[model samples]
Target: MSVDIHFNASALGSIQEVSLVLFKSWSEKKTLPMKLTKQGWKVSLSLPAGEYKYAFIVNGGIRLNDPEANAYAPDDDEKIWSVLLINAKGQRLHSNQSYRVHLHDYSLATRFDGPGLPGVHKQINLAIDESIVSRFEFTQVEGLHTVTLAWYTPDARLLQWSDHYLVENETSAPIELMFRCQPKTLMQSPLLGIWSLKMFIDGAFVLEDDFKVVDEEVYSRRDFLGCGAD
Candidate 1:
């Protein structure tokens, strides 16, 4: 029996075109196109258990591998290909089940198109139960830029704290690292409300953004923050 696989190429966001290629088993060697969905660019395939080499063709020319690839190997032409190991006994949805399946465990990668400058933006986590996401996307000059985040409850209690580092080469346009403050995990329940967020860049306070969580799609906020968040 073969296993159904779902590959996500949403890291590049919505661009010109995103395609997939399979290698290793000569019979399954082919290129497949991905569709842009609400969650992101996704494509499903059926295959038996085996270690296959694959790569993504972006815009019909660029041969890019998955950003979240587990391993990578060089092809005969020295071109690199991402590796994926499929387990025959892996967990899967029922044949009649109408649900989504992630490549591995549920990856928490969110798609954020940073067409604008450096700042935090609000997004919804469609992969989950449509939760809240405070996505932070930005670009900067050389040197190690450390992003420190702290989430506080409405009562001013510390909810979550996280930090990430990014080192860029000496260039004008560098890849901007994407980070987010979800305030909770898929396993744990979320506390819906406007949560305060304090961000620090390289040890200094940079900015403060709030995440207004709700169960609906409409965007809104109160005129005044009842808590003293200064």
Candidate 2:
């Protein structure tokens, strides 16, 4: 079977060579033969459907993470991504298909907003879901601060759905308004899976937008302003 792995490195940097290895189990022979390309990489091998462990050997000796994997590991403060190989016939080979993986630096910076701030220094506790699927941080400039949260899909598709909370003295505070700019794919799900915002001021609801559900990916800016004060 031929498995094609495609990736863009113009965002990360020109890569010299890439290496990959597949392990049949925790204590099995290691399969380390894959090819690289200008766009990504591909491999041709004949193996039965089963759970496998893999890793990326970047350049020559640098071990890196897989950008396409579905799961990730937090080891020594490092992230790793992996994928599950299944029979083309759609039969379950392994009970656990969820693999931990990490995003390439290029993909992370280009596809998502960064420094997680609007201006100068600020104290923020950036939290992400266990899947590392989303991130939250706070930015401050001259004592004026705002919280910014971001989410993304495995394919580097930005998830438009998100929420930010304003707190004062360790308690939720009222927000004046909230705004978000996201891609149209969020409208694909009947539930408007893209980014969303919820605002509250003085312990009361100020504004909320669930977003319009649609069939296509629509990139647009949504604003919620002039909410009431309680």
Candidate 3:
């Protein structure tokens, strides 16, 4: 099913051009030039059911994110854009651990001791994140499960980690996998902005999430934040 997606541009007035860039498309044609309308700058795309990484190319040089997009993701150049999650029936999804195939529960947070350990997924501390984990629990599925976690830096570098598990619906129980990141290298001052994580089960797209990389203290007065979930 193909859904009609309407992208209302941010009020970046008096710009020369506004083009919509959709990454991870099924076809080679990804970028779509938007048109101005009475409702301001807008673009409409007939997209299939899947997750799309997108951003707005304003004036052909400046890359801007759809402020009102479902979510935001950073590209290879550390340029922050937007994310569009489409379900099978052409509905927009927020990735709040909704009805996903073969997935039971998914949670993301930073390892900072506070009133709420690893507070929210919005802002992450760069200094004191000695232990950060991405946990996922899968429903009972028989056979060998190979899960791969791909991490992307703000500037679009890669750090990948994988885990293998055996499970049976009748005989074996399941344990949530903790994909830990190199805190000293990952959460630091130099690497600050948006970082993304992709989970692939048996070479199939299972789920994806993004987080902002910031420089702040575990219990400090101010907050140095990155990009994602905003």
Candidate 4:
């Protein structure tokens, strides 16, 4: 069987150190093929049909959650990572197929291709349950930028509502709405903010926007309550 693992560091310029452990029964042992790269890491291993446990060691200890891992083991302290066991016929041999859960029907909306500047604008419309839930005014800079929108549930857990925006060329370029994330609870009051903006064009850094996040009180008192609440 072939196994692949991938992951990325949480912060820019941070080096990710990693290790892989393979276990079969309590005694069976083998070596596996592994490789690491700038984007993440990958490993390929061949094994007999059976159950096994693998661990990823990173930063001097075991790591959790391969961002690119498609399998997971439920652990309270860590997000699960994906794993797969395949048969000689190239079919996945790990069963319990009836209980598998899948996520669908999630979406994000934003615009690309805007004038490149600090206040260049675009709008984002979000709808849920057939109702218009929220709208966003995205301001673009000359390079890469991140916007963080967050809210709190009635239960008081802070939830993130966010996306990334990239401006590829200095002139008129095709921009992307790129990534969008939706929090699981609608009961949470939605809060939004532009967390950071780092811009680069023609392979050189041009500008950076790392503003002090406005105090939570400002968002709490505002008339807009995020994407889901009136």
Q: Whose TM-score is higher: candidate 2's or candidate 3's?
A: 3
lDDT of each candidate versus the true structure: 0.52, 0.37, 0.59, 0.36
- Number of clashing residue pairs in every model? 0, 19, 1, 7
220 Cα displacement, candidate 2 (Å): 53
- The best candidate by TM-score is 3
Q: Enumerate residue pairs that collide in model 1.
A: none
- The TM-scores, one per candidate, come to 0.36, 0.35, 0.45, 0.32
lDDT of 3 at 217: 49
Q: Each candidate's root-mean-square deviation in Å? A: 17.5, 18.7, 14.5, 15.4
lDDT pick, better of 2 and 3: 3
lDDT of 3 by residue, 124-218 (tens): 67676554577776766644444556666677555444444424455444445667776466443457788777775533456767788777746
In angstroms, the error of model 2 at 31 is: 5.3
**Could you give candidate 2's per-residue lDDT for residues 1-230 as a string of tens digits?**
44554433332234666667666654674646467754566665556676555655545543434545443333232323354566767443433443221211111111234443233111111121111122223222121112223333323333443333333233233222233333332433323233233332211223332222233443344423434534
